[model samples]
Target chain A: MKKLINKPDDVIREQLEGMQAAHADLLKVNYEPFYITRAGGPVKGKVALVSGGGSGHEPMHGGFVGHGMLHAACPGEVFTSPTPDQMHEAAKAADGGAGVLNIVKNYTGDVMNFEMAAELAMADGIKVQNIVIDDDIAVKDSLYTAGRRGVGSTVLIEKICGAASEKGYDLEKLSALCRTLNQNGRSMGMALTSCITPGNGEPSFEIGDDEMEIGIGIHGEPGIKRDKIKSVDEITEMMTVSIIEDKPYTRKLKEWDFGKNEWVERELTDEPLKKGDKVIAFVNSMGGTPVSELYGVYRKMAQITDKFGLKIVRNLIGPYITSLEMQGCSITLMKVDDEMIKLWDAPVYTPGLKWGK
Target chain B: MLKKDHVLSWINRCYEVLEENRQYLTKLDTAIGDADHGNNMHRGFKKVHIQFETLQDKDIGAILKSVAMTLISSVGGASGPLYGTFFLQMGTKAGSKEELSPKEVAQIWRAGLEGVKMRGKAEPGDKTMVDVLTPVVESLERDVEAGKSLVEAIDQAVEAAEKGVQDTIPLIARKGRASYLGERSKGHQDPGATSSKLILQALRDSLS
Candidate 1:
């Protein structure tokens, strides 16, 4: 492929090195082969958070490495998984007095590699707990295949979980919270333009200029439907309505007591959700979508959230996670309790992600 | 035909095939699935190639195991685990053996299919590699029952696999990421089935 790279084999290495050089204040380059975290890693007494996957989706595990996110991110070759050895080393490096928590996506390779790495680390006296992210709602049958692929909501999960860990939640508690996040969150993405792999040189797939696919997975996998491009409002309604109906978030709100200071059992209803309840809103770009478009989506999301009266305690807007250079975005909303809201506001700093601390 | 070198050559050939098709596979995946299938298989096969080089004097089982480990590590999508588990199960059946009888080969194929079933949790109508593999394995059994030698059975298996791959074009995917497309998946040949056919073809080519 004709791109600005020294060699096809060295693209990930070169890109990571460049990322390190450009963001020196926020990043650190690990030695060759096992490029895990070394900058803004977990403190001596804090629990470590490590996550990674293929290299094409930038600002994910790597960029999110800083104060409030991952302790280290093991970047594999473009769209490939990092070997178990790399994950093992990252776990060791990030492990402070508290154990290390590995945030793995639900892809088979990622799951197996991370599982093997956890086994290897345990054999080496390292305590590694793993939480797999499977928040995408594009797929319905988790019983059949490997389940839904982790998508944009993974960034929000990491941020919230990191906040929990920062608040001195033990490994078990953090792991539990991670599972809760997975259960409570849902995402759906779409694509307009296909992305070009660094070495492949050409677009991964041919998309007509006028058409769009909805219910697409993050990796540019075919979507549920290929049809005429719809307006932003139509797309938003399709995604949000499906997810909301699937999860029945509006009905779940009735089960919670807003001011009585306790969760109360109630019937599921379609009533407008009340304010004062905590929520996290994420407008994530799918690789190539610009910030301007994402903001438009965020504005739409804000309008929708307003109708529900869901308090937007936290709003994350950016390409925190991506699908190479595919053109689209997914919106994720996580209803939070008071404790989660506090953690969401905690400060932390890392390469591409930074807040509170 | 069907010598020990034949299987080794087939594995090595698969590495080559994956290397060559990496971009195309990833490109196809970018359209309807995660954009990493090409890179994942390429990485897995590259690792297998390295392990093959390192374990030159080892048995076929060792070689297959090495390949399996490599694929499991390097490939990051569904194909990685399914293909890796396929080799791993094959290796488990023929552990450290320098060669296999026709029966042994058939058994290995069955075991490999079982492993794939266990890992992917897919069935024939799901429009998965199973759609290709199930028929091939059955064809292998049928050929062996008809008094065919190992080479003959493998030949029939490859033919069945090719047919199965072609058949995926009309069927809707009901498993894996592609299954999410429902009826839209029709018309395009299943990529996993295509690669699966290629792999079986490699084996047949090496056998003959």
Candidate 2:
């Protein structure tokens, strides 16, 4: 309940205003139906990338809105999905005459809102396609549940796909590349503490001092199971093993069929990881977990990947995607091809993630 | 007969009722799902309440359509689209109508219920708003078929919704965030169902 904020109602708006002030050179913020887009406006003749979700996960969709990353991000209330109007407006703002690609995470609210937005945008004569990411391995049944929550892999998709767009990839090609990345990535997380949303003014879930929840999503929702607190190595091993050894996930996902101009359900499957596959490993914090401790988790992750003969050709460690002050970390392993590696190494500049020019 | 004023009264009653039960619904959600159902519902209806200024002279269909757009734009969770679609379908069914007979009201409820089902894809026992809505719609339809008055039919529908809320306490969740908990989701009342009951109660109170 105790946090630094003027009021619960103004939290999102004030934060966005502060972000606009701090990063004016990089992005522009639109209020009313809130969304953030690149400062100089949409890149001409390039496929624009747009993504969004609930607000608590900071430095994600918003912070990634800059050069070589997301072109626009629609932020909703904390832990709530953004409405269709925001996305529709953002797509209109970011479309560069090539088309627009919506990088949606696979949550019920997020998917439904984005689907509605896609419909709205298409009706406006804008070419739009949606690629949903469901890379978390924690949820066991897609048929019975909302399916695995999209976690760290979203960061990777935005970065790599952003680079692809910069390289003149068209809307259809960008959508296909996004699907490939989603199929190859898996993530798992563990939380030592719960997060308090500003509006609720309470911890999302209560946890015992001596316990931790495993298989957690970015939101402070309770994970698959709770267990006694273990050492960093043990926790890392559990999460890494789950990601590396996860079975191929098959689920029915809705995609817009341009031919019919409607949403259609298609069954898609993510292939599992195996030995000799090269990967870009990402270790992320859930807001409150410090980078120094993430190194401890990463140290163990590096050793485990070596033992499994999975080559970690690239690695990103930090709070690239995070929940609001929740003490936890998640690890994502995305199998990479030569093209993906080239994209990963491409020059990029954003507030949350910046390197290589 | 359900008149335009009655529909407006129902919406205003929903805003007040949801605000009053906000914490209680959030508490219910804390047990089995993320603890935001109350806040989400209140937020959506609060926006709907503001639109009442512009809605006073509109037809029932136009009023409900405005409410749907407000909720869909302002409310940013699973509840937003589910409830938004409910109102949208109701508005579509009641198009250009300033008043409705008992059967028309029943048909509107049926359309709203089916819209919720299609949007959330939850069955009757999935411990969602659909659980409460299904029985409410069925009760209204049955009562209307039996030549009941508007007040009488709505009263029976509210009772059915109340029972539906209680019925969810023992069932396992198979949809939404609560389903993530598996069997742990049992024993707690579904927050969505509870709020749905309030929606029906608001209608009954409006008619009375």
Candidate 3:
């Protein structure tokens, strides 16, 4: 609540304005249904990747929009899903005639809005498809609840799928690859502190100085349980082990069925992380946690991987995806084959992530 | 009979009620879900209020449809799509008529529930907005069929909605972010359901 800001109402617009001014070289901003697209956009003949969600998780959908990452990102109010109009406009802006792929998270609101946008985009004669990322292992229900909330793996999917699209994969191919990446990825996160969304101007959930949320979702959704705050190694061990040993997540998800040109139910089961898996180990700070703390997390993560006989071939440590000023970290372990590693290495440029241009 | 003026009054009262209870709604949500229900509802209604001039001249169906569009675009959370679909379905049944008989009013509520069911995939015990809305519609229809006046039917709807709101306090959530809390979500009132009751109360007041 003490953070610098003029007013809660102006939070998102002002942030976007600052982002637009600073990153004008790589991105272009639009309002009245806020969205951002790559400045040199409509990368002709390649599939366009559009992703969006609530705004508190920054350097995510928006910051990733650039040369070789997301083509466009639709931003809603803090912790609120964007309306369909923004998604539809983003699709139109990013469309290069090859078709568009919407990378949507698995939260109920986000899924519904993205699905509506896909239908609208298709009606306008732009071929549209979508992949829902529900890689978080925190939420235990697949048969009942709204399904597991999408979290850390979202960043991985954007990078890999963005590379595939930039490499001239068509909409169909890119979407297929996205599903593959999502299937191979599983994540678990913990929160040492709660994030305060600007609009609410209050911590999402109150926790004591001695407690922590063990399996928190990105939006500050309640996790498995709260307990006395443990050492970093202990926290890291619990999250990493849960992701590695999680059962095959069974759930029904909707996808844009190309053959029928309509949304259809697709059952997806995430394959568990296995021993001897070659993986890209990602230790991401949840905005408020410092990079130095992330290194501490990675140090413990590497130890855990070694004990499990899983090889950490490559690693990403930073705040690539974050909950606004929330002091926590989420670990994503993606079982990577040559194709995925190749795509992960192919990223070019973006405000939040950049390398291998 | 539910007239066009009644519909306009309902919308106006809805805006006022949400604005009045915005902070309370947010505080309720802070305990179990993201604390934005009040903020979202107020923002959605504020848009409808701004465009009320243009919407007033349209038939009830068109007016409700415009409200749906404004809400779907303005409200940012799960409520945006849920409430937007509620009004959209009501608009379809109410059509272009300036007024409605009791049977027509029941039809509008029926279609609205169907839309909520389809959009949220919620059931009676899910501790969602459906808990309040589904019962309100059922009570409204039953009272109308039992030879009640328009005011009597709305009174029944409001009573059922209030009861439904009370019912949500003990149930475990099976949908949305609240479900993430498991048994801990039991004590907190469902913010969405509480707001739904407010909406029904507004409808009843407008009819009187």
Task: Please name the candidate that would achieve the greatest DockQ relative to the true structure.
Answer: 3
Q: How far is candidate 2 from the true structure (C-alpha RMSD, Å)?
A: 1.0
lDDT of 2 by residue, A167-237 (tens): 99999899999999999999998899998989888888889999999998787655778999999999999
lDDT (Cα atoms) of all candidates against the true structure:
0.74, 0.91, 0.89
Each candidate's TM vs. the true structure? 0.85, 0.99, 0.98
> Which lDDT tens digits does candidate 3 get at residues B146-203?
9899888888788888899999999988898888888888988999999999887888
lDDT per residue for candidate 2 within B1-208, as digits (tens), equals: 9999999999999999999999999999878777788999999999888877999989999999899999899888788888899999999999999999999999999999999988888999888999999999999999999999999999888889989999999988888888877788889999999998999899888987
Q: Candidate 3 docking category?
A: medium
On the 0 to 100 scale, the lDDT of residue B173 in model 3 is: 87
Model 2, residue A292: distance off in Å is 0.9
- Please identify model 2 stretches exceeding 4 Å from their true place: none
Output the lDDT of residue A280, model 2: 97
Cα misplacement distance, residue A139 of candidate 2 (Å): 0.5
* Selected candidate, larger DockQ, 2 vs 3: 3
* Shift of residue A211 alpha carbon in model 3, Å: 1.0
Best by lDDT: 2
Interface RMSD of each: 3.3, 1.1, 0.9
User: Where is model 3 more than 4 Å wrong at Cα?
Assistant: none
User: In model 3, how large is the Cα lDDT of residue A43?
Assistant: 87
lDDT tens digits, residue span A294-333, model 3:
9998998899889998998888899877888889999999
